[model samples]
Target chain A: MNYVLENIPERALKPREKGLTMVMDKGLSLREVEDVLETSGDYIDIVKLGWATSYVYPKLEEKIKIYKDAGISVYFGGTLFEAFVVRNQFDDYRRVLDKFGLELAEVSDGSLEMPHDIKCQYIRQLSEQVTVLSEVGSKDAEKIIPPYKWIQLMTDELSAGAWKVIGEARESGNVGLFRSSGEVRTGLVDEILTQIPYEKIIWEAPQKAQQVWFIKLMGSNVNLGNIAPNEVIPLETIRLGLRGDTFDHFLNNEWK
Target chain B: MNYVLENIPERALKPREKGLTMVMDKGLSLREVEDVLETSGDYIDIVKLGWATSYVYPKLEEKIKIYKDAGISVYFGGTLFEAFVVRNQFDDYRRVLDKFGLELAEVSDGSLEMPHDIKCQYIRQLSEQVTVLSEVGSKDAEKIIPPYKWIQLMTDELSAGAWKVIGEARESGNVGLFRSSGEVRTGLVDEILTQIPYEKIIWEAPQKAQQVWFIKLMGSNVNLGNIAPNEVIPLETIRLGLRGDTFDHFLNNEWK
Candidate 1:
């Protein structure tokens, strides 16, 4: 099924390096997951079982199979990893991932406070076993790390063998790069972008306005995470410049 | 399966009144709708097929059957009625509703410029045939009617035999009794409440914060509309004082 907006640029299909869209699965049923993939599968590259929701869903295996069948990479949210780490069940976590056929893993100290060296070590260790994605920044707004520290953390994680470093924005786009009003802190985004390689980072932008801001600032190829399942088509429209937000940005651009 | 907060302010199950939660369905698949209903079916009173999406979805009968099986009332959005009225196919729209087993309908003049008398006439006409819910405000924020006019519209619609009058907030909470920041325009809400019966109004609040504000300002039994399918449980939690926002509010009181 060809999407209506096929003329726009930077919309690489599956196995894409640029314009990657990651969806957040917050306790969707197996059939719901299948229906989502059937309708908007082409636009999604990765699916993150959001926060601690993976522990709640009864039929996790069935849900994983549905996503796998649709050629979408599935991974647990960073908070889930923090839960495992806090419980001292990292080995058990790896075993569960292997059993469930999950190829990707997120390593972050979003909830649980962990030292930078320890965080980097896990990133390196996980990279040897599976594709590792490490996240920077705390979930709590009060404990927000400076932009320089975030850039440094991104560098350390990438060096330690993380496939991509994620900037935490949580489920609500109120904290981390965003203010209480959901607007991106422009200076913070600029400072982080100046130090970090944009290609190796996936920014957690859960809102439409946030997605539009990032796409406008970093181009359509900017990797985005925590997208709602239903918003996949709308996000794709924004990425391809079909949506009003980024239409002018890519209208005259050429696709590789 | 019993939910975690089952004991909290036990709402009337399916086919309910008073504490009604009407979800806005904007082109969701059959499986997606079923998944949402499975988890939060008990809380949902009505599901509005948002805007013109009902006319666009494939296998409309199958979708309606799924909602009916879950014991939920399915209705088309008011915009569809306006569309039908524009095309001079009101009879055809009624026949389609009967064919699809839809029991509820919305009569509104949000999109088109219909006279107040004509709108009230349609509400009376629709009330005779089906469960008619008349909406009071326009979709465009710039074209919003004053508080006095809204109160008059609500009173007129209810007098014309409509079940409930819904205030237009569109999908985004911004623009109608809500500021550009999605905060409730307190002055406007207060003015409208003074003129209209609280029991007769169903405020369309699509955002979680907006839902929280309504539950906090107007008690647990406040009627709300345009809720997302997944948010049904969360909204119920807030209404019942199970979530942190309301838990802090009601737990300190004698209600706990």
Candidate 2:
């Protein structure tokens, strides 16, 4: 079940802090979920039920149990939280999470306009019960928050007891740190990195080039989120310097 | 089960010749495979067992049965044929196909070096036994065949009784008709279109933008290949002009 690439740096197994890989599950069947966990379970640290998809499936509890039994942390997407908040059902959302035994929660205002103080209060409330991974960025490409604002939000969220802050790239890897063509805006990434603790930030890099760019810029242990389930092993390969892009990078350096 | 976008043009269901979508299955569990078929089965016409991944998985027979039962055509990737050819096991390959009850096959020289005559011979051989889909273009980006040569090969394969010719894009979508950035080489695509019947060509467009571009360039009925399992519904949305990209495209046009 070892997904570590050969002739490259090895990563620590489950319960790992560094080199954590979070897979985006857009409604996979229970058996298929188990198959992926059986094959590449060691490499997966967290599984996020992708955007508004968790509510569509009827077997949510069973799916969550399968993921939890495999020692993988499970959480719903930030959009689902936004949906709950919009409906004024925060307590109902918490009850549902408790019933499903999901200990990891993602809090964000990506799809809604919520006040900064209100958002921070929710983060602090969730942090006392579960791992609170707050996200900073607007989901709509046209309504993207300024980079400095994003930095300020990340800093504030961390100060408000959020375990880690995620940078939103959505599923397409088009907005936020990436251009419409999916290329990383190096200057923006550099500006954000300078203001935040690299270890406490997770970049949602859903594309190969974006993953490679983040790995090269932030080194191998950079936390990446929103990875597709199928691309889990491929991302691990890039992280461990087994893929072509990093293979060349490591070969050129020959030291680290 | 209907994945058709309500706002856009509707496509013909299973057994469709035009606007056909062929998904690439690297390795999926029975439940995972069934879940995809349940959601987007109507949009998918074929499911290709990508490369030699079929050989690595333990339950090939069960997987094929599930796809077939869903009324979806199932076939092995062209790379598997190249692997059998390399080992001089074409007879064994045919036997394995019979045992699994596969009715479609792909013949290609993507991985192995083979002349046009040999490639066509395999196409003819497969066509007599099963529905043959030949693929043109090399897997290695550095060794890309010219557009004119691709035109000639695709024409020859069709003449050899192949049902359709797929232009290779691999899973990464970076090595064939696409650039390193995954953008389609528009001029090259147009050059190839000039020499081949549009209906007979199935472009491997794994990326969302590429899918949108192909649908726009070739119209909604253009046959596309190498689509990931999860993207079946999204690709259908693009083809029907339901998604934002195509929605905007159609909104600008007056005629339906």
Tens digits of per-residue lDDT for model 2, A164-253: 999888888988777778888787778898899788998999999999999988778888998988898898878878888898765555
The iRMS of the candidates, in order, is 9.2, 9.1
Clash pairs (backbone) in predicted model 1: none
**Candidate 2's error at B43, in angstroms?**
2.5
User: Evaluated with DockQ, which candidate comes out highest?
Assistant: 1
Model 1: per-residue Cα lDDT over A1-256, one tens digit each: 3555555574566688767889998767767787788889888999998765555455677888888988999998776665556556678778777888889999987655678899899898888889999998776667767778887888889999999988888778887778877889888889988888787889999999999999999887889999999998898778778888887787765677
**RMSD (Å) per prediction:** 7.9, 8.6
User: Model 2, which residues run further than 4 Å from truth?
Assistant: A1-27, A30-168, A177-256, B1-6, B242-245, B253-256
User: For residue A153, what is the lDDT in candidate 2?
Assistant: 93
User: Taking the candidates in order, what DockQ does each have?
Assistant: 0.06, 0.05
Candidate 2 lDDT: 0.82
Candidate 2, B25-54: lDDT as tens digits? 999888778888766677789999998898
| Residues B1-256 of candidate 1: C-alpha lDDT, one tens digit per residue | 2113213455554456777898998988876787787666767888898988977789788988888888888899999999999999998988888888777899999888999899889988877788899997777878857778877888888999899899888899887767777888777788889978776789999998899898888878888999998777557656765443455454432210
Model 2: how far residue A55 lies from native, Å? 13
List the lowest-lDDT window of 10 residues for candidate 1 chain A: A1-10
